[model samples]
Target: MSNTVVNSAGAGLVRAVPALVGAAGFALVYLVSGSISSAFASSPAPQPNVSGEETRAWLIENATASAVQAVLMLVSVAFLALFVGAVAAITRSADGPARRWAIAAGTAAVASMIISAVLSLLVGGLAAGLTPDAVVALRTANFIAGGTAHVALFGLFALAASRIPGMSRPVRIFAIVVAVIAVGSLASLAIYYASILILAGRLLGMVWCVFAAISLARRLKQFPPA
Candidate 1:
């Protein structure tokens, strides 16, 4: 029993690592980007009429911060992918279909991360020195890419959680609902008030991370020692 407890704890810690890292990275990005956006929102500069404009303002305010956030986002995605993979490996017996979904979801997340990273580099560079028009174009591109990637991550997380053996179905369903909100918000980013939707999605995402951490810890408690 002691061995089982120890093994479970180790496994849980390993499984929880990705979610924890992702949550931390997301918080960093949200806080830094949010601060930047709030500063710009108070500025006299004309707001860019694009999706995630407020968030983009923060990225434009500081090139280094933008780069850092982009990298952090990528790292977060990698961890999320790992979390999904771990879930699939651990819960193959409960639902094979869910496991496959988890794998595919992880793949989508990784792809989105890669795309976002490249776009961030391009946009961050352009924002460093450019005319208003050029900045608008770069900002538009960043919004589209970032929004899409975020939606993908949320969707995958929801799907994977639903399939995991020990997770409550209600929690899984809530995750799915959050994913839908995220995807909807992303789709509406071009609209004026869509940022609110995106913001809501991010809030839901944070909640999901908490849930994931708890679920993973519980799973770890059940593992046999290696």
Candidate 2:
């Protein structure tokens, strides 16, 4: 094979790294940490209301599990941040709509990370000490930061990516699908089935992360750095 072909393959593999990391992060959070948290929730110690007393009791009962899950989630956020950065880097040189959309997506990703960090830290560290109002505030922030901003931001990013010239049909569709699912996170606002909807959205979004990671990996393997 020609030198060009060899270089292209190498590049494609390199590109896949961010996607891989993102996928792993998702698995860690939604799958592994999720399982742990689920156990806690199922236990009798868990309560539905967002009260300081309940928070303290739950924390006391599931302290180890909660802490572990929080750490895992925090790591996942870091990986996701990396994923966003990688995507932005890939699109940084583009002009026009692609550029605008990619920029929006990256900015949104950063903001989402900031919000997630705060939420995760609070859950992991200060659960026992929070006031009732603080607990309520966290829930409100979770909806906007986690549900609204996160999905909407990523959706905009996907919109931009899907329009990039010469982008593959599969990848474009994948972005669109992921963005829509993420936007579904807003279902967190609902009273009856909020957790179910949010979880579903997040699980669906995992498809994007895994697929994107594989695609980037393939691209890195096939292409050369400019």
Candidate 3:
């Protein structure tokens, strides 16, 4: 209702728009790149426990697709960074705990995106030149960093956002659920079968961001932040 809140809300809405576009962009990139990689690859896609030879072969065959995926992933990370900033701005007017949650969310989001971006760079720029064992090691690290760690930290962000006041009940609950799934993805490290949890959590988290962004935008328009 105050001028500060109004300005923060306005800025948040502006940043939230990128979350929507980033989500869509990531999804499209995955679909297109996944298809291309699958089509070009002689071997199956690399798994968490993939063999060195298999990963090297896949990397060699799909260098172009991997590069494309990496470039787009970096772009997605930038958008995600913007979204985190947006959430922080929107919560700028909140009380102590809420503001702290926003800060935590921002931190977790940044960490997640950074890990993912680094993995993307490794895959895009360095995979081809590495030895088989090194490829396997790096690829495994990338999988853990980009998949399990990324989603789990992102879940922390969602959990933090869920604690913020004024989000719709459904959105809050959804965020909590997404966070649980994402954080739970850590189990994948121990239970390879649990990798499904990582996939589910990551996909749902992206959707949750878009939903929250839209909800924030609607609230801003309805209340005019003042």
Which candidate, 1 or 2, would have the higher lDDT against the true structure? Answer: 2
Query: Candidate 3: where are CA atoms >4 Å away?
Result: 1-19, 22-33, 36-44, 221-226
> RMSD of each candidate?
4.8, 3.6, 4.4
Candidate number that wins on lDDT, 2 or 3 = 3
Candidate 1 lDDT tens digits, 17-125: 6555655555455546545533433343334463445445655666675565576666656655655555555555566566567667666756765677777777766
Residues 22-83, candidate 2: write the lDDT tens digits.
Answer: 66775566577667665655354343345656766665566666556556666766776777
Clashes of each: 1, 17, 0
The order of the candidates by lDDT, greatest first, is 3, 2, 1
lDDT of 3: 0.71
Number of the top lDDT candidate: 3
Q: What is the lDDT of residue 135 in candidate 2?
A: 59
Candidate 3: lDDT of 80?
Answer: 70
